[model samples]
Target chain A: MFAKRHVISMREFSREEIDSVLDLAESLEPYARGGGCDALSGKILALLFFEPSTRTRLSFETAMMRLGGKTLSLGPTEGSAMAKGESLADTIRVIGAYADALVIRHPKEGSARLASQFSPVPVLNAGDGAGHHPTQTLLDLYTIRKESRLEDLRIALVGDLKYGRTVHSLAYALALYGADITLVSPQTLEMPDRIKADLAGKGTMVRETHALEDVLGEVDVLYITRIQKERFPDPYEYQKVAKSYRIGAESLAGARDRLIIMHPLPRVDEIAPEVDETRHAVYFRQSFYGVPVRMALLKMLIGDRLE
Target chain B: MNDGEMKLRVTPIGNGTVIDHIPAGQALNVLKILGIDRTTQATISLLMNVSSRRSGRKDIVKVEDRELKEEEVNKISLIAPGATINIIRDRRVVDKYTVDMPDLIVGVLRCPNPSCISNTNEPINSRFIVKSKNPVILRCVYCEQAIAENIADYLI
Candidate 1:
């Protein structure tokens, strides 16, 4: 169903399509772990990242490599033609000629959709500023499906909800799976009413709370996010608020043993390092799930030629 | 005629378009969408809050020498969904029809999100998917952000 289609937004995927990707990712986990596959032999994937990303870029590259496909990157923005004032459309058009599919991560919202319009090959949005990172959302779903069941599970999305693009897309996907969601954030960072309203329309049972500890005990999954200091006007206020949101061992005393903690990583003090040793920490494995999830996507979009 | 008589008598347009049954105060917005400003050479007349038998109160815009374009008419449908377009030639109504809101509104309205790629230097026109008709909700085809309220403010 994903053949040659642009993966720009989570809104584009229905429940069946999301389930299909997760199922495919489950099948490809063996190759993602150690084995090699020539599903996309000789295919070349292009990466154009206007913004800096470590895990996303690496996982995408690794996913392509594991599939017996080669990958090329535009490298740093300062060194690429983009530094010379080339538009994203021109760059996509030029690079699309050399690749089977294009993965773009830009700071501008809807940049991937614009690139798709100009690109000859399919376009996958790694991320666009405060927009969508469908691949991340997919991998996140894979992680949740792997560690814990999606249906009827209580998932609390903590930290920055208003500005955190990861949580925004993840929330919608979780709601689609019929997971009861609890939004834990500072009042300033509460999930937008529009998003909550949309979730409610989907028949999702949603709750909003300012304290993470309030819902940490009952939730099946604790999704923590780093409170971005840049989003706040006062640094002192950020430090104070950031401290209250930190998930440490002490904070998990009342948490259920089955409760798994997941975080989209490169985390800055949101999930305490000490908690990494706990049985609840699936975030490290969660980060690794990106490889297989992305592998499933790359194969679906461009693997037909090899067949 | 004095100011009082001028206010009482609304002039008819010759060889132009008459947009009647506008939602009362939206006549100015319709004019704005048609690019009728101080620089416009056409004789434009906007009658606001006129008593209407159908909708209680309505507005009308008469352009003496200009007819509205397709894109302009579509944008007018956003604010004045029930507005009727009357084509006037030689001071007589030649044709009349109600504006139909297209399923896809393209190049007519801007994406209100400042960070939207359409607002950037990309070589593309602004596109919105009409999600609702009665209230005129538009979802940006690119960003997927909904424009539910104050939609006319985003008209290009």
Candidate 2:
């Protein structure tokens, strides 16, 4: 049962738990498509965004609304008490008193976990600074399963592997399903050693390379992430790797027809506009899946069905 | 004097504790962990960089009329994983045991990350999971940031 549980990391979920969530999401797909459900009628969710996130924030709010639950939103911290030097724990403690569950996004790593320690209700991580985003991972998993089979598929995660928290959490979730993962990134933005070690420890097949062309034909899924300019300590370093890996339509010539391309949105140039017309492009549909996936998550966390 | 005959000796305490086999140059860190400074009333003897047969060089701390608490011993293990704690009673070693590194450490050290919640105005204690013992790698339970060096500076 997921009642009162804090979803801080994808690593915290077992294969069975992930399956349960996916199953719940599948069952709630019709309900998310304008059907009615009062599973969370009296429940109130708190949305605390210390950072700017349009899609994630909107999806979570929409998810709660679809479930007949109301939301209390605290937008960007600039106008909030946090900018006035309020602590995350203090904010969570105060908000936790009012809501049935809390969804938090912060610019600092571990902010979600830190809030969870003081929150009386379940805390869902929207995104943390270069840290885990469990809900995003959950939605990504749902998309992958819907588009392609989950097990034993060759998946290539391309772009800024070092700073993309989405790739980090997704990699861990894919590892749970025994997916063969090829991490494609510039040398400067390669996956961290700790993550590689963890994948190896889990007996997950992992391959690292700088070029996407090498694994294009073999992959069943191409998960792309933007090479963020903000995560760099040196602007010069960011400029060097900015255009290193671009996936245009021409680049997908050798790729499998069944290959599903996905990206956590707000993409700049990492994914080409022409790729949007290709059959492989499922990233747009992927964004829509966030609603039902998050609705399932919220329901499981608050409703008596999963209890 | 011959190398074997040049043993440095400190007067034994009537009743207290002896922490031996500490890695060389960590005696001060041990004192910091024990909250021992110039203002302390207890009689304390610290021997640093002393030659030892077990290890090439070691540090030791002897405190009079004070036995280390279990929590204090755990903290010392973070800095000196190989240290041996010996309880002295009536000038005799009554109990002796080497420190065992704990799997989880809570509220003992500050997280080095300035952005960590533990560093904020929030009322939360720092928590770390011991990832390695030999080099003393501590991964913050919240942020998953690994702290490998300058651990003494983070001690609470």
**Per-model TM against the reference:** 0.91, 0.92
For candidate 1, write residues A120-230 as lDDT tens digits: 998999998889999989998999889988888789999999988789899888888889889999999999888888888888868999988789888899988888889
Interface RMSD (Å) of model 1? Answer: 0.8
**Chain A TM-score values for every predicted structure, listed in order:** 0.97, 0.93
Give the top-scoring candidate (lDDT): 1
Instruction: Evaluate candidate 2 and give its CAPRI docking class based on DockQ.
Output: medium
Looking at chain B only, the TM-scores across the models are 0.85, 0.86
Tens-digit per-residue lDDT, B1-156, candidate 1: 354664567866669999999999999988877777899888888888887778988899988877777656867788888899998889889888899998988887889899998998777899999988977778998888899888777878
lDDT of 1: 0.88
Off by over 4 Å in 1: A305-307, B1-14, B23-28, B35-59, B63-72, B89-94
**Model 2 alpha-carbon drift over 4 Å, by segment:** A1-4, A229-244, A305-307, B1-9, B153-156
The lDDT for every candidate, in the order shown, is: 0.88, 0.86
Backbone clash pairs for candidate 1 read none
